[model samples]
Target chain A: MPIGIVSEPGREANEFKFITPDDEKLKTGEFVYYNVSLETEDEDSDLFSKTHKIFARVINRDECRGYPDSFLADPEVNPKHVAKKLGVISEDMELYRMTAKIIGYYDTRLNDFTNPRIVPKSGTKVELAPDDDLEKFLTNIEDVAEAFIGDLLHRNAGAVDIKLPVDNFTSTHLSILASTGSGKSYTCSVIAEELMKPDSRAAMLILDPHAEYHTLKEIEKMEEFKGNDGYKPKVSIWGPEDIRIRFAELSFREIISSLHNPSDAQEQRLREAWNRIQSSDDYGQYYSVNDLISECIPEDGSDAISDALTWRLRNAFDRELFDHSRNLSISELLEPGRVSILQLDTISAIDQQLIVNILFRKIYRERINCERNRDTQLDFPVFAILEEGHRFAPANGESRSLPILRTILSEGRKFGFGIGVISQRPSKIDDDILSQCKTQIIMQIQNPNDQDAIRRAVESVGEDLLSELPGLTPGQSVVAGDSVNTPFLCKIRERHTTHGAESLKTSKRWRESWTKNAQVPDKVVDADQDKGAEDREELL
Target chain B: MVSKKIGKVIGSNSHIDYTCEIYRKRDKDNPPTPADHSFGQFVYIEKEIDGKNIHLIGVIYDSQILDPDQGRTGPKLAEPHEQELFHPSYIEEKMTLAGIALLGYCEVDDDEFCSNEHCVPPWTIEIDDIVRTLSDKDFLKFHEVDGEINLGYYQNLMELAGPFGTDLLSKIIDQLKDMKPDEEKTLEVIQKNIEFSKRIKGV
Candidate 1:
């Protein structure tokens, strides 16, 4: 069914204006197309039909004709009635002029659109593109590796399932950018569930800063993820106390950053002791922070520098994380069909950065060794998602993890290592790190700086879609970049596992507490009040 | 039903408004009175265009009573009854003139009047064209175009009816509402708008 006719050329070359009486369906972001007859080059060069469908998106609409202003003067009289009295039909009263931007013709060979660099001529009939065609051409991905994340936004529910390729996003890196409480963690859980499906039994790691991903353990119990070949997925959770890093693995900078400001002489002495201990026979295999401290000798027969270094080292390395010869092995952290979550809710910000730095470095080197056919503990690929990515690779401040994360993001594709950075503040994340993730799932962001940062970094999302970000409700997102054929709005699917990061019910909890307090016996309350009065008198 | 002849076209002061002289009696009905040619009454003059019968529809907007013997100081020639016996054609000069504003036209077919009404007429009426009072049925049918109540000649009527065009249209719309009960609400809206415009424009 044809919806409208091309009225004239638009303000831009790739845009055209069409007149339509359909005020309901032909809204902004609607997909419509017109047929164009291609000029054949030769008589025998014919593999397809000459008539091709040129798709376009409706970008703007304006009313070109309506009832006169005077007809609407009387409040009680409807404008339609006035027009009817004047011998005009009700439907003919309003005429809308829709402006559409051409999205080019779909090419089967390329599985994408091929821009013809030409717009339809005037008087061409433009029809609404059917849902079947949109489902076929809008995305190009294999069905086997499809991660059924959500459906297309603005379309009817379940009209088009937006299935992204797990292979593309995992290999090239991915980012989930949204404001707080915008379902960032919920979308991540959905992806995790997809990865743990029977067809994909992917090895994954999540650096959960707030203990929000522990609910992923439910995947092991779900029947959907169990394979027919008796294969069941596994989830491993490591709390803050169990997350350890050997003291010897820290670099000179990492060690110095952990301490308060140290004098130049103390730093020099520490460096000397560090190098000496590193060259010793038992440095990496079996060593402790006590050894490093004991090795720091007095300079010029004075014990001032060594004594000060001793106190700082004891204070920084006394935590359970920096242990001696006790750290998680690479083989234990990553395995096929297993998800490992390292909960860092109890750790401080600086220690969290150092932990991420060490883990990423070890993972990168181990993957490289495995790819090169050398001795390695782990041989399979693994993808790690870092929650609150801005704390790891902040733009305004330095972090111990930023360099290694950047290195892994840039070169990890060949080595079968990938990173997913999830952050609420895109502007605070390093520009290079944010751009390296080729796949972006952007939700509602109210901050102008974050929106501008996305505009500058993400080239795939157009201005029209960017403007929709501020108005998007929770669970709606704009998926763009390599994983999708074109940028589009998506309504994220529900998570198979229960979400763990819901906001606390403050009002309900307060009411419950107040009710419980009111149920206390009157005699007990009087006794407590008498004791409180006696205690006040004693204090006075 | 046959249309009752009320008068004949006498003269015209303008192209759209024509003067018609009303008669005191007609053959098929009782003696015609002033009410037959009253203001806002539907009337038409039959004419032939290109060998086809057409009726030029109009409405009586104004009326005049001519007494040519007013203010005559001459001696009394005879009594009123004796004058009628002596000079039988003397009373003919005392006539009633009606000002008819042409609204539109309708085509006549077979025995039916106003088979299809048009808002614009291609021809004008002659001096002696017989003006007849349109029946209530034909009057309603003339306003019905394409099965809806269409006052397409609303602008023309407003322009040609002189100072009292708004009042005349209000009266016609009221009659139409009573005849067309289905379109009563919509016609009421139009009537309210006309009343509002009359008050604002002070016409």
Candidate 2:
């Protein structure tokens, strides 16, 4: 029962010096508890005294090991197994003391945990929190509208799988940052999966550039998590073929802004051409890019300006960037609690920007309308998620979508317009937007500049966590913000849906192909490929 | 035949108090492992004060073994081999010691024999007093005789209040299934303990 003894009285009432038995697991960040009766003065009282135990978090550990690592490394030195029988310099016969900060104590009278009012006397025996106590602390829910992200990890131990209130987490805006292979997208996928739960009614719109999340439509079918039967995420995938936006719906300034850095004079001339087409009876109603170009070609606003406008318009026309029907509405796609992924991979960069610009603008406007008027059809808040956010909200270069995104990040939450910016390079994300994101889901980031950027942006993340960021395993993240009771080091929970953004194992694929080709006849491989092509066609 | 004296009460603190510490030395002959002063093992601090042989009874609720020189003191630990040359090996070798936490004592009649009634002892022990094992044989000595007892004895031992009390209750429960003292005597002892707590609670 006496696992350890309080060695030092901490500067605070709750902090204590705990001398622990030298188990390899006895290290910093371990949780330990010391028994302390609330009424210390009632020494003679028996059953009436309210005895409570205070829980403390070990911040640092110090040990006097039996032998040097060098001595242990030396092959010539026989391990002192005899020491165990003698109870001398054995491996387990070492002393370790941990500096633990008292977290809080359970109030038996109030039936809830409260901050420590009295410190346990020095030499207090410390023990591991019983399973029940640990479970109660970790599983206590702060709010009902919580977003289930992952299991909270306590010093390599799983405390509990708890939820983070999305109302606090998302409405304040959030950023998921990590290196390319550090499970950044997987973390986002977990969030997406949670959002798309059948019972959830929060809308999430993912601006996916590589069509990474389109497979979410069949994610529940993934063999690993097929047990999650009730988890059906209402996913709507929008690709260029499935979506159409009228060119006439875009303003003259929006049209000119999509050009490759059009000069001020060129912008002015294009604006005049667009004005002339709208003013005329034949094309005044709703003009397409072709009509705008034809009007520009006959304009008297200089031939050079008309030629530039025509070339830009012709390029957009060739790409089939627009349709007469304005059918893609964020209100329709990002319905409450539904997950919609726009596969912008098929669209050109210029057209991608124009489309993202329009989508974000519409979402922002809808949220504003919803906030102002309760009668708005889509009354719920929506989180606009941008994958590879660096492309859209780059710190260095300006993009057509940046202005509206900046506006959303700054004031969107006020109107139930939340933003989730997923980025690998936190340093490359616009500081204004990054700073506005109150909750930061930081995964393993090895870059010092990115770490520095995160440090400057997130005041809640301490030096200890910042130091630990680079060493975190994939799918492990530190959640720091007002959303959680405290900053949590957590292992992301298994996604109910298949992780659609996982990188292909190039080596494994190559090995399978080469080995199969060598073993099988060319005719057989050809037939297999033909069949695979047919299967793929059917899947499409 | 005198049994081996495993430890002695440290005179600096009051042995009469419900809780006390016993220090034991391990030499060449006694290479005492943690097993020597295991938890839940009951013992007695025996002394001849004014030729009145006394026994201060308690249970070993906890034990701490230390070779201070080898065991780091401060929260600051040095590098893996930090104290290799700085600390004297002689200190570690000679200072190997154990301290057992003893809480709960019982009352004995004038004839130096325990009775059905137990109480917190009034006498303390000197450093010279010997700490000897209080085995099941010693527990059986408190057979049928009645004596003045502490009113809170039931709360201290039967209700399972302190470390020793809980351990004693557990020990009794373990023995109960095997009918160590038979059902009648066990029932009588339990009834007496509850009656004592009820009387104290009424007061």
Candidate 3:
């Protein structure tokens, strides 16, 4: 059915305003269509004798009441009474106008999309597009199940499944942007579930700040249906206790960048100590921070800064965190459809950089080697899902992971490598690297600066869509870039496994405790006494 | 095709494009105003020009109504002056008129009628043409083969059944539940919708 009549005409930077009667179905973000002609646009166009239907996304909605200004301008009548009258008068007083941007044309020939040029004349029809129509247009009517993430939420009215083309998206990298509690973890787990599908042939490595993705090993309860219903996931969990980076692998640049801040003399001593330790090669296999500090010597052989170096090294990190153990090979870390989650839940902020740096360097080397037929495990693509990216790849200060991460961003796609950087703070993340991620899955971001960062970084999604970021309810997101046929707003389907990282309901817990404690058993008590009786009680 | 009585064409203008005003007044005895004036409903006025059967399709997009001049007839309208209240004063009956914008004739330039196509006719609509909303048969016929508009906000607007809507998609699914194969995506959506509805009810 026609929802509105096209008020605007022609398709130069195409935009149109249509009066959508007082229908609530005609809303922003909905799709509408009108019949246009391809014949007029091209003289050689064949006489298909069909409607060259132009498709557009509703970006804005305006409401106009037919009431004259006299009602508002009148001071004699009570304003409250006037409002009541208007409410009782009728719905006819209100008019709804929908503004839509022409995204593209649904090309029936190629069965996908052709560059939209033809424009509908004034008074063309516009209506809500059905779910099946969307499915046909978006997927080109093919299953093409690459990495099925979620369903499209049609305003609490309808739902349809949607999938992403993973290989095409990985080259540009992806960012899952959301507010702290806006189903970010749930969405991430959905991606993990999709990747771990048997035919996906992709490996995922999650750097979990809260050890959330570690719950991928858990199977969903069968009583209620879920994604990970009956099968055991090929997932491994590695926490701080099971994690250690070999100190011998560290170069001078890596060591310097990893350290918090060292004075000129301290840096010299540290560098000299590392050089001496390398020369000896007899400090067993594993060398601690204490060992490196002990072997240090200034050029003048002074002990003035020895205590400072020792104290700084001891206080900066858990001295026992680093040890000279051979890092796990890529084969042990990654496998087809298997996920390795490094749980960094209990560690300090600085350690996140060190761990990511060490792991990233090893994966980079193995993948590069595999490319050259140099006997390595990473023959297939590896997707590293990095959480708290702003911490490791901060816009400001230096960090151990920054340089290695830069390399991965610049050339990882060429070598079957991609990274999914999950960050709540896009503004804090390095501008260069943040912009490099072409495919961005943005959720409910409320901060202005973060929204601005997204606007600057994302080129495909229009400002009209970006303006909607803050208003998006949880589980709703705008998927932009080449990952989708067109940049669309969709609701992610529910994950088969539990989103273990969900926030605790603190108020509910408090209320439940009160209810439970209300039934406290009566305790042994002394007989009640008056104020004066307490004085006589001692005598009694 | 017989259409549920929607409204009657009371006014029209062909100066810019074929536009008409539908007097959507309710008849207490036989009320048919509700379905007639909706913005997106496909409506048309039939015209026979030189033995050519023409169907000028249109959509009702706007509505307007002048406030009744109650000052001359009621207390509120007479607030400005005392003399107007006592005398026999009457205001014209206030009514709403839905504005209809013409899409085009149904294959006027072409020989064969394309049920799905929108065409621009060489002629405009006449003042005497009666405007009527599309029936379910015409609606189904045109929508099935004509155009399926796919939108970005598709997911947001779609609601699962038990609470039937203008689309009545849930009822359609319920009627076809046993007949639909399990392998189809349609079946999956229906099952999910049922589960979602059950969960919401339980909550």
Which candidate number has the best TM-score? 1
Of the two candidates 1 and 2, the one with more favorable TM-score, higher being better, is 1
The C-alpha stretches of model 1 lying farther than 4 A from their native spots are A39-49, A67-82, A249-271, A281-286, A293-320, A324-330, A522-540, B1-203
In Å, residue A180's CA in model 2 sits off its true spot by: 2.8
Query: How do the residues B43-124 of candidate 2 rate in per-residue lDDT, one tens digit apiece?
Result: 6776555665566665555444445546546653445466555554634443322333333444445644543334556555
TM-scores of all predicted structures: 0.78, 0.59, 0.60
What order do you get sorting by TM-score, best first? 1, 3, 2
Q: How accurate locally, in lDDT, is each candidate?
A: 0.85, 0.65, 0.66
lDDT tens digits, residues A347-390, model 1?
A: 99988987888788888888999999998877888899999999
Ranking by lDDT: 1, 3, 2
First chain TM-score for all predictions = 0.87, 0.77, 0.79
Instruction: Encode model 3's per-residue lDDT on A9-84: one tens digit a residue.
Output: 5234667788877557766777777766554333575455545566788888877545444334434443333333
Clashes of 2: 3
TM-score between model 2 and native: 0.59
Top candidate, metric lDDT? 1
Supply the DockQ value of model 3: 0.01
